[model samples]
Target: MTHGLHYTVNCSILLTDLPLLERPAAARSAGFDAVEFWWPFPEAVPSDAEVEGFVKAIEDAGVRLTGLNLAAGDMPAGDRGLVSWPGREKELRDNVDVVVEIGKRLGCRTFNALYGNRIDGVAPERQDEIAVANLAHAAHAVGTFGGQIVVEPVSGIEAYPLKTAADAVAVLDRVGADNVRLLADFYHLAVNGDDVPAVIAAHTGRVGHVQIADAPGRGAPGTGDLPLADWLGAIEAAGYAGLVGLEYKAAADPFAWLRG
Candidate 1:
């Protein structure tokens, strides 16, 4: 059975409910062999029994975990980010430990890290400095669990700080950790008015993850003008063999429509 691409999960796309025990089953039914998610444990993690069950379900389904999104605790109390968050650095570090533990349990090897918002009155250079320091700590913690940290660059309109792949690379360079890598999402590239293949080419060595959806509307790959097949080919040519995550919402059942 050929599952088109290396099927993986992005929690929000397949399972919105937290402490997801059934997600593994759902993913299996959908022909997925790997799963990923935002944060299953928000404020507090799921119980040991619950996690055991979830892990068992995944094992039963024969699916591996590709990555886990470590950017979930970044809201009011959590302060929502890894670096450039002045007062909440401690909380961020603590959260990283928790995320890393989850990854270890799931046998996952990658974590999607967000650098955080840009302060209204702060200079860009200062924000970069903060991101470098904060992400350095995060990468260290992730490494202890034998996991890799992927720095995702949000669009300037979506996030105040670190809004481009180039920006993310600069921060990663500053962090100077081999564990820190890059995460490229097509939507973010479209939002930021970027050329996907061009960015991929420029940063091939640092990229560890790739996500895709249609432009304008984040529907499945074929729904918009994303040129997904071509882009996938480009990334492949660039030497990325990691999962190309399909992180989008379908208007209907994802499998309902087919070319033949």
Candidate 2:
């Protein structure tokens, strides 16, 4: 049950009290050498200068950008993601290079795409088709950078179709893109009623990245009922050597939960 863990702070969710670009440095100050984030630009393709500034911030902070999310529609406003939404194909298409380019600069190889909420009046089949097409497109684009696309199953979010490893795998199958894989977030899987150990044991190879938050409150590890240390041990035991993204609501010091 012991393993070396490579932890990456999710800058988008953690260290929010500081400026967006400052979080990387803050994470470094706290002893982390790598970080990840959701899309930081409101425009999928922000000005080149803006991209430079963001990358510079990470470089200046001396933190490696390990993972990043593809543009999901205004996450602050709860758009979930537009990749599968009807009439939003253009938005998804526009972001393909934006994310991949950033990843290329940051040497990041993992990109997460959230499945948006089911839209009203949109036929399920059409939406699914669009999703598969978009996912396939992203997967191919990421593959150019030697990266992989990840689809995560969220918990307590009924609107999003992916809440189980099997569901994510099905999407991966539909896309038929070799680079697309499942994001086995223990917090989501446990809160959504899946056997965390069983899922990790079976799908270790397909889970390109891992994320964690305690169940019941989605708070920092040790704040809720999840046996996080054990779960992580299982993930490592299953042969996943990727960075584990620390994604949870932190009210105090972000590193408090991980310290002995």
Candidate 3:
């Protein structure tokens, strides 16, 4: 039913067979014309030469870089993000400049800002205060490059605050910035017990970006129990004309899901 939907591969989680710079080319080889990524560099801000090399890789691969996340802090080390942490405001603000530069270079319009996990002994209200202020800062910063900011609700994480679609919407409303919107990743929503189609039907207009992986296991479409094709149909039936990001792990030939 989602026969005509357009998709972009998130190279950060896919194409493990190749190095980071080569994944864009791999995506193009696998029939995708565009790709997205998490913050690619190990540091929040990498050197200009390093970034230019990333740009050149995408250029040489001939694929459009459509979406990118602002640095979320050592993801592998479990520091979910830096933007909302109380004393790390400087780090979060520093991250904005490079993210804006990359978006400008790639002509990318969507930027995702992940909310950091709640720090122990930090009140939720205090963290919420930090998050709102930080997101507003980011929204305006990204807007300078004509880019939109999106916040996502990641599931199975007790520490991160935005666990529902409503939670994400509240952040958007609190920031009250026209350029900020929801990420609406179906896999996360489903993992958190959301009826994906229902949520899509209700808040279609606010969904600025979408990411997908199947449920039970974060694998490609046909490898899990989610009605991915059906939900995608419903998403399209609503008004989202943006690209759906393939953000799942490469569990045994992920591209086969595309063919199926």
- Per-residue lDDT over 153-259 for candidate 1, one digit per residue giving the tens place of the 0 to 100 score: 77534444556788778878888999899888878777787777789789878987888777777777667777777777777777878787768777546644333
Scored against the true structure, residue 15 in model 2 reaches a CA lDDT of 96
Task: Please give, for residues 1-260, the per-residue lDDT of candidate 2 as tens digits.
Answer: 15687899999999999999999999999999999999888877789999999999999999999988888887767677777988888878788888888889889899998878888888888999999989988888999979999999987656888888998889988998879998888999999998888898889988889998987888898889898889889888888899889999889777786675
Better of 2 and 3 by lDDT: 3
Residues 182-222 of candidate 3: C-alpha lDDT, one tens digit per residue: 99999999999887887898888998999999878898887
**What would the TM-scores of all predictions be?**
0.85, 0.96, 0.97
* lDDT values for all models: 0.71, 0.88, 0.88
TM-score of 2: 0.96
Ranking 1 against 3 by lDDT, winner: 3
lDDT score, candidate 2:
0.88
Best by lDDT: 3
Candidate 1 lDDT = 0.71
Candidates sorted on lDDT, descending: 3, 2, 1
Q: Which ten residues in a row have the lowest lDDT in candidate 2?
A: 251-260
Model 1, C-alpha of 209: deviation from truth (Å): 0.6
Inter-residue clash pairs, candidate 1: 11-37, 74-80, 75-80
